[model samples]
Target: MTQCHEDRVTGALSVTGNAGGLFHLRDGAVIAVESAGSPGVETLLLSSGGISAEDWDAALVESVGTGSLQAALVARGSIGLAEVEAVAVAALQDGAFAVAAGDVQECVVVSDSADVPLLPVTGGVAPALLLAETAGRLDAIASLPVPLSPYRDRVVPGRATKSMSGERREIVAHATGRRSARDIAFATGRSLHSVTVEISRMLGEELLEIAPPATAFSFSHWGLPSLRPRAPGQSSGKEMDWTTTPWPPNCGRSERTSPE
Candidate 1:
């Protein structure tokens, strides 16, 4: 009996009898196995997810392009419990010494028929190595920088106050006032289209003022309305100081007695 071992990074693996072919392990999963061409050798597809042993059989037929290997291996159904135990026992009885699955660590080696364990070590790394590899991949993904926008630098106090998404806020907060859209997109991991869309939305809301092209500054000054004063005695209209000797410009003074 010939033994083979393989390691996987992300997807699953499947083995059809000695004839080599491709097989779907699961959604976004795939397995490739090479057999020793030994007669009476059986191909096994073990799955832990919703896929059943019958699904593996169909997948193998669709992928391997031949039913010769399918006829040799016995397909069995086992749920959440240890599916490996049943697969191993069946493989040993078929006078075979090699087995393959999507996960090597999950495979149980019950017999010592070959130099290595009776089970062919194929698919993802050993249980211990798998943990370390997964940690490293997660660290890389987490370390990736977040996306940002370039227009952030030109935000004037009152003008840029429109409600912005968190990503947009980060970009605006980091703006150095000199970066272009392309430059900002590169630095922030955001596409130019997304940055432009947010800027256009802010402009439409009057939160951002567009300055004329070719100007050193691209945005206009922010304007905030002032509060109106109330009348002194009535406490509602424009207030006037009657006690004072005179009033400033635009002041009207008239005294009219009302007839009862």
Candidate 2:
């Protein structure tokens, strides 16, 4: 979240890393965040069985039909309002985490006269809150033994558990000595913090063993969805598909009292 001085970015802040991303902040609050590594809200919902793929597609259609995805899903009884909020929050945190790991480049700003791209917005998350949650995740993972950072560390099945089932068992089973903690989180549709905390404990109990780290989620390997540019005649307020948009779309703009 470092910027020139304590100033918020005027446009898109491009970050380069294993998962390069664009962070858009307005009035110091993030509106839309796209990350090359983080899973989309749709992926989380479908993965967690919050909604089936078919239901997700139906929701999309419903969104276009109703002009609001949030309303369509809830109105159709596809998911509760709270679940939608949870998905947005998780996507925001994961996206922020990826951006934080990267070296932020100079941000690109749009001219006042130019039309800003109307990209889909997940939710507005305060940058400070995102950073705080990320720091908490780091500290939780830091409590573990050597070479575990949750994002990169891979774990393998060590000793069998006492037939326990929960986050701990889920993590140990997937620890395949290959998948990173992020991977486990996606597979289980749980938050990274919850997964990593269990991982630390499992490691302590010898239920999981650290594997020689493999190339975790890297920028090159991270799959970003394809974004179709809006037609030239498209209105800026028209809805855009949130999933297909790449990271670094128009994030947010601040109402600066004074120009930088």
Give the top-scoring candidate (TM-score). Answer: 2
lDDT of 1 by residue, 1-260 (tens): 11222332233233443222222121221222222211111234332233455755564565455433332222423332234444433332221112221112332222322222223223312433433443553344234343223333243212546677777675565444444443344455443334444554554565444433333254442332223332455332333444343334222333333322
Q: Rate the local accuracy (lDDT) of all candidates.
A: 0.35, 0.61
Q: Per-candidate TM vs. native?
A: 0.22, 0.64
Best by lDDT: 2
Off by over 4 Å in 1: 1-163, 211-260
Pull out the clashing pairs in model 1: 5-121, 13-31, 13-102, 147-188, 148-188, 152-172, 231-237
- Candidate 1 residue 66 Cα shift, in angstroms, is 32
lDDT of 1 at 72: 24
Range of the 10 consecutive residues with the lowest summed lDDT in candidate 2: 111-120
Instruction: Please give the lDDT score for candidate 1.
Output: 0.35
Count of clashing pairs, candidate 2: 6
